[model samples]
Target: MLEQRGILVPEAVRGRITRRMDPHVMRDWFRRAFAAAAAGQVFGDE
Candidate 1:
């Protein structure tokens, strides 16, 4: 989704996401990606 919008996902962030193992959290991030302008927005600040 970010790629479709031309937003680049940094390699470090990609690595972090790659290590993420929770399906619920991944689902939430996937939904949020549609509205996020940045990678940080997907996971929020929590």
Candidate 2:
């Protein structure tokens, strides 16, 4: 799908993204993102 849209991911870029996208890291990122979103909602979106 990405290739069909002309979005070419270079090998280096792919490698870096994959390297950091471990289950633990991804979970941590999602947790932080969700926390931020919840905070924003509570704060009324400054």
Which pairs clash (backbone N, Cα, C closer than 3 Å) in model 1? none
User: Which candidate number maximizes TM-score?
Assistant: 1
Best by lDDT: 1
Report clash pairs, candidate 2: none
Model 1 error, position 1 (Å) = 1.9
Per-candidate TM equals 0.80, 0.34
Task: State in Å the error of residue 20, model 2.
Answer: 0.9
lDDT (10s digit) by residue, model 1, range 1-46: 7778887888887887889999988888889899999988886553
Looking at model 2, residue 34 earns an lDDT score of 41
Point out where model 2 deviates above 4 Å: 22-46
Model 2 local distance difference test score: 0.44
Q: What range of 10 consecutive residues in model 1 has the weakest lDDT sum?
A: 37-46
